[model samples]
Target: MTHLDHITVGDQQVPVVTTTSLVIGTGSAGYNAAVRLAGFGAPDVVMAADKIRAGASRNAGSDKQTYYKLTLSGSEPDSVRSMAETLFSGGSMDGDNALAEAALSARCFYHLIEAGVPFPANHSGEFVGYKTDHDPRQRATSVGPFTSKSMVESLESKVRRLGIPVIGNCRLVDVLVDDGNVRGALFLRTDVGAARSAATEEEIVETNVGEEPSPEPTGTLVEQLAKEPSRFLLVRATNVVMATGGPAGMYSDSVFPHGQWGGAGAALRNGARGHNLTEWQFGLASIKPRWNVSGTYMQVVPRFVSTDAEGGDEREFLSDVIDDPNLLASLVFLKGYQWPFDIRKARDGSSLVDLLVYRETVMRGRRVFLDFRSNPAGALDADQLDEQARVYLERAGVADLAGTTPIQRLRHMNEPSYQFYLGRNPGVDLEQDMLEIAVCAQHNNGGIAVDGWWHSSVVDGLFPVGEAAGAHGVYRPGGAALNSGQVGSTRAAQYIAAHRAEAPEGDGFDAVATDVFGRAATLLADAVARFEAGAEDNTGTLITDVTELMSRNAGLVRSRASVLEALEQVTQWLESYPETVVVDDSSRRSVNRLFLIHDILTSQYVYLHAMKDYLDHGGNSRGSVLYTDPDGDLPWPDQDLGLPEEFRFVLDAGALDGVTQEVDWNGAGEPVFTWRDVRPIPSDDDFFENVWRNFRTDRGVPARQS
Candidate 1:
């Protein structure tokens, strides 16, 4: 392990105590990294984060477990390799390494179950799987819809059992590096509000060094003004692993709730610092040709049928008009026509599946109404249906379900579902609902470019896992994110362990710490200046700008114009960021203002990167967004974005202009921003036959036997 230099606490320098393998972020990736390191007998493994499970791992709607069934129509037989290729198929950057990582991730689910995760199981004790939109297989496994919750609980239990030290509510402001290798990190202990004031004063002292030290430390003033006490912590370690999630909170509106956005904010701020350090000492390599995340995959479960005054099921009527082969397939699977069916309708023929999907979309302020109100059964046994509905409503925290009719209940359930489930309802809705729904920003399929071994070309001793790494390609299959986290974490841990002996003793550890602290102090000073200038007081304006841009331009639909407009708005926000201010309250140590500032900055980074990628790969709506352009002006071919190339980086570097550049697609290096040769689907008779076969097989319901 690397030896620590002096620890800084409110201008007081303390000697290093010990060193450990430090895992940053406590979500799935971080947890897995710590667990695997401990399993390998790495001494003094410490996992730290601002908020552990509060990130994407906990905020995700479902656990989504399998991808074997998500093969593109008429593609080769599904295998781990084939799946990887498909995931990286698009011109969007990501490469083969993502495929290997995802393949390994699939096995992680089994590992979770072995660790006593208690995933939903059938009577036979086999894991019960269900179908979701985008995937052809009913391979998704969950324990209730709160798969993230269950997964977090199980991992948390495992971490505790290992007796690994976990420091929560602490932010890692900087990573200290020496001689092109990672040595340790600088952290701000955030448990005590009063301590934060002291730390702020210490920061001022550290910056003003070489000059006479202030006789009366400004930290004292911070204490006098603070409403609560704050504490700061610093940890020094040999190895550091970044398992931070994506940037969502910085954006005004996201598919995830408010809290989930903070992870993105932290990652953006801290990641920028880490990347910068790596760039200065060691040349950085990044996967280029980033994949375009056009929009979220949306499906709405049409459970409740809207009715007239007399009450009628409009859904059944509309069902006749719309050829809902997907819905029928679900019914067939649930009725024992397939191997993994668990969904069952109430006695009145109502299913929670539709309601769950409907409520989620409604809460997002999107339009979702059922058409089955005119059907004859819409009015059938209102009282009995209401009773069954009551069971679900109560569980969802809908106390007023008793007074509302089924149709009315559907409308009322929207708010509560959003408040509770993060915009998802389980069992009561069909997975098909996700197919046609509008969405807020959900996942970033595009991430840092990496190789098959999970190595970033930009820097050594730096690894990104889970959502932070971006290995899933353009569109990830359900449950694949969990798989990616496990795979990346495991690979990273193995690499670190194997290379531990060869790692050089870092030089200038103290100097690196000083630099890191210096940067953080600068950021804080700028933030303070903004607050004092009253330029940062436009919190409401910033919020409104972000919400409008994201909702209108980056939502479930997209076009070049809208995307460009959104980018323009993001640019303006970024320009205005340095001037933003904090109100300077009693809780200077907690630094909610700093948190928000970081969040906004990171959100802008993601938005700008995504927009640039979208423009580079032009085509009609390919994934979730519909492209109205008849000519398909996009430069990249219309092939399904595969995993390998989309996730791996061959070269990465930051431009002098501050824009980060990456090279991907098997060392094709930096993309020329030109169109590629297009490939056409074969017209052979077997093509259609195979398509029919796979479609029928995906439903797991027999179409016809040979």
Candidate 2:
């Protein structure tokens, strides 16, 4: 057990302090909460986190717009009402009301614009829009491809302008809750050495913002020490908003390194870390699990097609000859590559290909090449092509090859052909173009379930926003994530503001403070003992283990066996965690230790809970498949049981304890599933209407009829 020498209260090391609201994350949602609360005249809003903008908001591709089209896509006509209903149907929905309120406050975009966010605009000054894969309309509005960065900058600027004090690099150790209400949080500054040595260099770069060169001699060690241990800042509040990004740490395998990938889906797993709040709510907008589905359905764009010396179209011949889906699938798997170009067979038996710029090469040494040699040179927009070329070169550390055809040839020659064409004479190049092929992790429609007002059922005074909250049903429309964040945050702010004034002062604050400090003391003692014993038992290993387990068992493809395996792995990790301890030189006053511990525990709980629910729901193929074997076969445990078709209802019911109700597929058959419940549709509208209706009612907005 850990022990504490003292606790700090105000300037004195005593015990506790209280405030009006506590905003728990530094991302878009947290910032929104603080700013909104301040605007609404809430006193003393405190924003806490290990790092702000380090969550999904910072890592997002920032496709700005309401993904109304994707939400409405599918065979059955889906409306706002149906969308909301499905979001809430699984009891995982939270913040429906908040989302609705945010929809009403669409002018928040204008507010962001005023904050200097550079949204893409057209010649007429209206927002420019583009279409995405699942979207039914051109709703995505981007500022080049770095929209997430731009938005983060704008939000950070606005937060500073509002005079909101942010304690960066500080991690919350524990939430102080009393009588079921949040009082404050325990915190610790993460010791620089505690993070992996490799991360120290990155940390330095991140923290050296706007520092000028020093001409004088460097300061002494004593001088640096005097400035060390920056004040342990804590803010007590009556209300708290959890805007931590999604559970990326929880699903580390599926998510790309921070800021490397363009999709928001992979970042949703970060919310898993925040699920530890004892009194906080948990819910997520449901979204279609496409990352595990269409994401694996590989397509390629041929950059340069080869032709024979006779000048016959070699590219045409290859397209005409290679029309087998099995061959294509095999090629994609063996080459460890996905095509960049959209290849389609024409009615005349030739291929119509839309060549795109190449992004990254596959392991098979096949460079993504775009075949533009056959087209008139410069027929395509030169500026757009140049921009893409620059982006690829910068990311891959390649030199300028603009307007060079040989570069395309070099890339194409290095690529391997499918087994079927191994002995065939590869043709000569007919066209040379750059092709960008990226196999990115996209879409995490799964998350903490939320209602119209992003609050958790398990805990009050806790709200989740952005990708953390699961509101998008089975499939999220392309632009809805942005809408969810903006609207969810705004609505959460409204709820906090409205309730803060009426919240009765209680003993929960003191009790919460005591509990938090007690836990911190225990952690500190554990660290000290670990140090004394000269043992290295940190939470990172456990976290990594969980991540590996999730990747192996709960990723891309899933089956009964894999889900069960994941559940078993989670249980084993939990059992092994208690024997582990993190050692840090940083004082107990900091929040680093608290943050790490909370994150690890929360991650485990949320993932296990989610898997439990997912397993409980036994249907045909729904959401993303998590456990498909290498041979691409589903492995259900009871395949030969020959149970009634209705028995499969367990799959659609989500996490079933004794309390939660099962999905009523019989009543709302059309939207929830395609075919019969026995043969589930890959994607269907199971609970959209109910989820949307709740959202509409929560926001006091008129629900759109289906």
Candidate 3:
């Protein structure tokens, strides 16, 4: 890392760091990208993050967090082309990216193994695997519940060993641009005095950092800011890799670990186009220390219970809807394998469980829980379970037809599942208390657009890998995201090392940097100036309002009116944010919150706009999202499900599968939305000599077509 001449912004001296490559996250993808970039001979690489210990990669996992890869052990007939075809089969996915992910899956997976990610392997030295949702082949592997955490730690060690600089406590404020190219990036440093704390008051000169800087205020806010210093840090790089996770902060009911507010807002604010932003995956997950409650947690046939606002009136909500106890148990068991809520399965399949959860939690304002202390409907006879459920339970050696409770079955079947909750900080003993759960946002199927090499489609010198990049589409195989992150980061690092190795020419960057910093300073100053000592701190309320709005209208269930209303409200929020949103304190925490709210609102507007546009385009219920169609038929009309008219919906059934919705925010009124036909899978020539010649020339990184 090289430090360039310092620039003055609003009476503060800001340090500018320049590098060949700058990675803006510290997740598995970001760490992998940095390690690979340095390994591939990139001159210099650096990583910047808001918090080093935060992010989903290190803090989030499931019953058995999986890593999807090509079939390596089984005799199943699997090939690169076959895996690519399966990935492309997911609606609205780009074919080239699918092919790239498939072709490089093994390389990335092995890279993880070499980095010390202990993926299970059989005695024959073949990596064993199991099938996951939407997977045709047995191509999923895991190292227990902490699979991603293991991957992050392993890759992070590689990054540290490579001597990469990881600047922490810096939140990305914006992606600075020059004309149409990515010049660099701007970050808000919460720890400002870490570099030069000994500067005397006599040496420092006062200058107008904001639009007009005046005498320092004597208010408590000024003293508070003095104690908690904040400054802006500029990173000038030739290549910027956005490996930040998905836009998980946009929804209140989300499984994304806290502090995983992604960089999509920064990319989108700077002209990066979003692809298929409307597609997201939602599933049942625990509340505190948020974690996915998939696999055996559901397979145990835990009793689904709900209570009123005060947790008084306890009732088995699922039993209220479904009279057949066996069918209910069967549905809950199926949720273990078919975890994500699927519109196709909403009729009579497992996803009906998700709907009931949603109805109880969101519609009726009740608290839902998975009660493991007892069985539902008195006693559950495993022999009476549906054939699929009975066989799975018996195969797992937990087919207790007697009086065993869910907790006992869980302990006998998967001890790791029981221990996970038992070992948490505010732990829950399944034998004693119920596990609070809700239908929560798990992942975004689409995000910032990227091409085959994981390079940004909208900006030069910009690459978006991992969840930040929209590699998946309407539906993806479970655990495919982990593979996509590794593969995409590797592709990005390779491309950068080969083509964009040199630092960006620092000719006109200072001017651009100054302008960008000036805008941020003005916003911060204005917010500070508007701070009131005893003013009602609506900051928390505002965040809750927006997040709840998303969860209610734009979550699994949606309607045209609710979406439009939410969109309009968000627009109003965005318009009045500067004037309306006030800070309780001017500390680093408050300042970070100030900027993050802006990012969240910007993301919400763009996402909600994409959803509204899709509805306007006549897009129906598809993927995890269920659009209300009053004219449509009820999913289970034959049964007295008591589902409201709002639940009446029709599935798209591949009608809109061939197209992708793209949105771009110009930092103006509303983001521009458009639809484009999905690119077909390529049929490349496999002639050995021809491919070898091309590989020899370009190192197999194909040139982008003009």
Q: Top model by lDDT, which number?
A: 3
- Per-residue CA lDDT of candidate 1, range 128-161, in tens? 4555433554545555434665566678678877
Q: Count the backbone clashes (under 3 Å) in each candidate.
A: 88, 116, 1
User: What's the residue-level lDDT of 158 in candidate 1?
Assistant: 86
- Score residue 694 of candidate 3 by CA lDDT: 92
Q: Global CA lDDT of candidate 1, please?
A: 0.44
Candidate order by TM-score, decreasing, is 3, 1, 2
Score residue 184 of candidate 1 by CA lDDT.
Answer: 60
lDDT of 3 by residue, 534-559 (tens): 45556668878999999998999999
Model 1 TM: 0.60
**Cα distance off (Å), candidate 1, residue 139:** 3.6
User: Top TM-score: which candidate number?
Assistant: 3
- For all predicted structures, in order, the TM-scores are 0.60, 0.60, 0.94
Q: Which stretches of candidate 3 lie over 4 Å from their true place?
A: 193-230, 532-534
